[model samples]
Target chain A: MTHFEPISPLSVLDPRDRGGPVQPLLTIQGLKKYFHSAGNSWFGAQSVVRAVDDISFVIHKGETLGVVGESGCGKSTTARLLMHLIKPDQGEIIFDGEKVGIDIPLTEFRRQVQMVFQDSYASLNPRLTIEDTISFGPRIHGMYESKARLISHDLLARVGLDPSRFAGRYPHELSGGQRQRINIARALAFNPRLLILDEAVSALDKSVEAQVLNLLQDLKEDFGLTYLFISHDLNVVRYMVDRVMVMYLGSIAEIGDGETVFSTPVHPYTKALLASMPSMDPDQPTREAPLSGDPPNPINPPSGCRFHPRCIMAEAACSQKRPALETTRHKKSMAACLLQNRDTPIPFPPIKVSGQ
Target chain B: MTPNQALETQPVIARSPGYWHGVIKRFSRNHVAMGALIVILGLILMAVFAAYIAPADPIKGSMLRRLKPIGTPGFPLGADELGRDMLSRLIYGARLSLLMGLSPVPIAFVIGSLLGITAGYVGGLTNSLIMRTIDVFYAFPSVLLAVALSGALGAGLTNALISITLVFIPPITRVAESVTTQVRGLDYIDAARASGASSYTIIRVHILGNVLGPIFVYATGLVSVSMILASGLSFLGLGVRPPDPEWGLMLNTLRTAIYTQPLVAALPGAMIFLTSIAFNIVADGLRGAMDVKS
Candidate 1:
């Protein structure tokens, strides 16, 4: 929201187009994953859930790109697709300017990219000791046992875990936050260039979340790594990422500099998400949800614009014609909406918060 | 190193005891299971040392001492219908009984688990193909299937063991496949896959540790079932040939003398019941202790 925070007045931190033609490290084109539902009855039609449908984006080296959306928006699915955990029905993922697929070999792409899952306990094998869990990636990728063991202990120490105290402990013996740290350490064990964290910090306590976020920033700087950070918390995303991508029912609704998107959000769905975040200011008045009712079922999504059913600005044309993502005058902020109305440019709404 | 880094440095901590230790500790607490385990251990020791521990030669039958009562001189538990030393024969029978019960289990566990883990992890067409084929064996009651197969294969200890092993396989596979299916969806599996681990590696290293415990516990339960079936095979004279001191065969041999020497005749039956029940209680204890959910 325009008046949501004191940081809104600050300019964008994203590396812009004016910064001398830099090529993106990874480029995704037309990705889609549709899950076929079981038959309703003996003869009922099998519906399909469009988990990720027709999305494209690029990530540059050493950049932290945050993906935010409500549940069922396919935020986690996108991460799995990048990791190649689940095959996309249709898409081409171009990494380092080369087409990455059957020919280039997935193991080569996987060696460079690693993902940290949201549920920490579920992400670590319950049977493995902390040392084995961390070393599993390296040992399988051809590192010798002794060298891998040394690397695992080094990673444990780097992630703030005392190697001697924590190395032999299993996942069940550790707390939620400690396990999350181990998850991060395991991702870094492979010496990956790109780390995709799918809601990695969303499960931690407030204080632990801050510590983890700080650890991530330090790791990114030290390792010179790029991150595709996914989270539901806009506040944390605002503090951590360079650019942000807002998804709605598996399609990108807004993409731009993190500051611009969070401070002056143009898409209707993005505005609603910001409003949903609990404000610390007791004096600030609560704003009613801009759009109500659960998101349309993904199995049979609404026609045209996926957000049309809940859109307050929906028009007759909204139901029949989709709006393409277009850039604004800021050169960084972009949104997909039929209500651009350039002359007045749909006045940016003031968020009801105390600091304003 | 920096000060903060040094401050967070962990000291060497003693490694705690592992999962099996906890299972043993828990099992020790269950009195029924402990008693059963003790009995089972005794039975195993008897089976191992039967040649030395037995009071007299088990095979030689004496016509003058035929049907000797309990506490008779030269016969500790008295003589059997053929005037054979009952104590010696029962002790010697321990080896064959345990052999019949346990021999089929490990073979079935290894083969069934392989089929199941593979089918479950590889899901869809391969899963259907393997599982459906295994299901054909599942169509009949396990005992009936064992009996029919062994009957068709002809009577003998080897044929009985083979048929019983076949009978246990489908159920073990079903359990392994279901448990594997459940473990297959956990986040660590996807994490392992993303780490560039091959499917084979996933099953052996990652999935095996988690699913094997529950499957093994389930197989322990099958051990008792296998023991009973093996005894049944010998009772019908399809296993452990005559005068070999097999408990089941002894039961068959002593049936005619049941009226005249009732107490002596009941000894073999009592041994069969106690051993099977001991195995069953032990299986129950192992299940409770090995339960990962708890």
Candidate 2:
């Protein structure tokens, strides 16, 4: 196996850092959102769409929790739910030890929690000057000093853009990467405690993505911020996040430390996702085949386990009973699969870690 | 690091002033729009200085000089049925016509934009109610609605202008609502909301900034419609009454002299066409210049 060098996590100690203890920044419990979709008139009754059915996770202070899944797996929806952009039918979102109930004055919540969207190109207002765009939040939140110009300039410099040079420009003037940096600058202007990056760097090219990822890592350290990083690319997630949560069909299939989850995936879905990553070496022998079929429709999901129909190691019990996410023999990891209960200990082939 | 060193490390082309200048330069290159802008400016100047430009008294007439052909010595564009200098009347007519055209547009724009922004950004029940009300007005043809409103309000210049302005509000509101709704869905708006921006702040800063440009462009296009409607109302004696020197009223006064000097009677009609087309061209140019897709 190729010895991939492990990158050290960036650390910048803030005055507030106690070094002894820290609390979880955000905790979501039993979050569920079912979208009601009208059925065909010819059919008997209307059906319900379980967009984000029973998903839960906790993001600690100064850490990034990466959620990885394919499209329509409710990853984006979950992020939106956390941001409270869309109201969830059922869920408990606790922030800084306070349970966020319905109508819980979003202004304060918004200041604490900010989200960076996927499409950087369409994310900005075309008509607004770059300075106005960045200063917008500060002005709205009343964060500016008497000299707003000086403060705005400082913020622009912090984001690696000169206020004098770039402030007056509009969105159309900047490139994809530059626009994304501006987006980040805008989010950070308010000094948010938690940043929800919803595929933030997905639109950029590889080189730009790498630069942005580095900037994010630096920002995280500098601010001591917690992040809920959402993405479909497992490698990028592995590189950026401290822990990983694998979601499949609106539910978490697995959750563990990033290193452990990548090195030894407990869930079959997570294993398949890892296998599907295009290998860096083209000449290497082909790995396992990509996922067989499309995800089951959210309007009417399959019974028992949602992934059972497509899972390779599925058994009779997997098709009959819904598996709950529980700790495996290694208590540090969690997986929702009946196979973990089997006494046979199915002899699965060993996964080759790239940086062994 | 020193401030200069930090500046040196920054991207070379990231200067804000230079970038904005580039956008402005690109917008300026549109020739048809520039020409239209010049025409509108000239009309505005002419309207503002209408009294000084007219050669003879607009309301005072010469029965002997009635129906005189244009370019006949002292009188240019000849005289109307009342024998008032057509040139003088045309110049003075610009004041009322431009006022009637431009004034109602902004009124409609302000009312429409507020309703539209609220409807679009709020969504749900509010959106439905406002949109349905706008839909009711939209069902009527604009000219018919103006005529109906004028008829209801009874035939005065102010009443006609009011009716025309009301007639214009539905479309402007519809445009504003649609544009705002689209803008509200953008990630920046969501980002603004996520940054603890109040609903008002998000709508004003993010949504309004994006939506207003297109709405203003559309409203500018409506100025011509307003001019025509104003003229039509005046022609029917339901707008500015006779002897007011309004363009539409002038056209109506000159109608009887069609057989004798067709050119003289057609002068006011030609002016209306030119001014309306000028406003339309300017609107079109602005739409093209402001459109990001273009």
TM-score versus the correct structure, for each prediction: 0.89, 0.88
TM-score of chain B of each: 0.91, 0.92
Q: Provide the clashing-pair count of each candidate structure.
A: 0, 3
Please state the interface RMSD for every predicted structure, separated by commas. 2.6, 4.0
- Model 2 chain A is weakest, by summed lDDT over 10 consecutive residues, at A1-10
Give the Å error, residue A183, model 2: 2.5
| Each model's chain A TM-score | 0.90, 0.88
lDDT of each residue in A1-356, candidate 1, tens digit only:
11111111103332222232265767889899998876563477888999998899998767899999989999999999988999899998977666777545798888778999999999999888898899998899898878787788888878898877788788888888899999998998876778999999999999999999999998887666789999988899999999999999989999999999888788877887777777778887545544466788999988888888877666788898888888856768778877754555544433222210
* DockQ of model 2 vs. true complex: 0.42
**How well is each residue in B1-294 modelled by candidate 2, as lDDT tens digits?**
997787768754354444335435656898877787788888889888888887888889878878888887788788778788888888889999998999999999999999999999898789989999999998988888988899999999899989998998899989999998888887878777777678877777677767888899899999999999999999988999877888888888788888998999888899899899988988887777666656
lDDT of each: 0.85, 0.81
lDDT of 1 by residue, B1-294 (tens): 997565456455436567788788889999999999899999999999998899889999889899988899889788998889999999999999889888898899999999999999999888989999999998899988989999999999999999999998999999999999999999999999999999989988899988988888788878778878887888887888888988878888888989999999988888888888888788788889876456
**CAPRI rating of model 1:** medium
lDDT of 1 at A39: 55
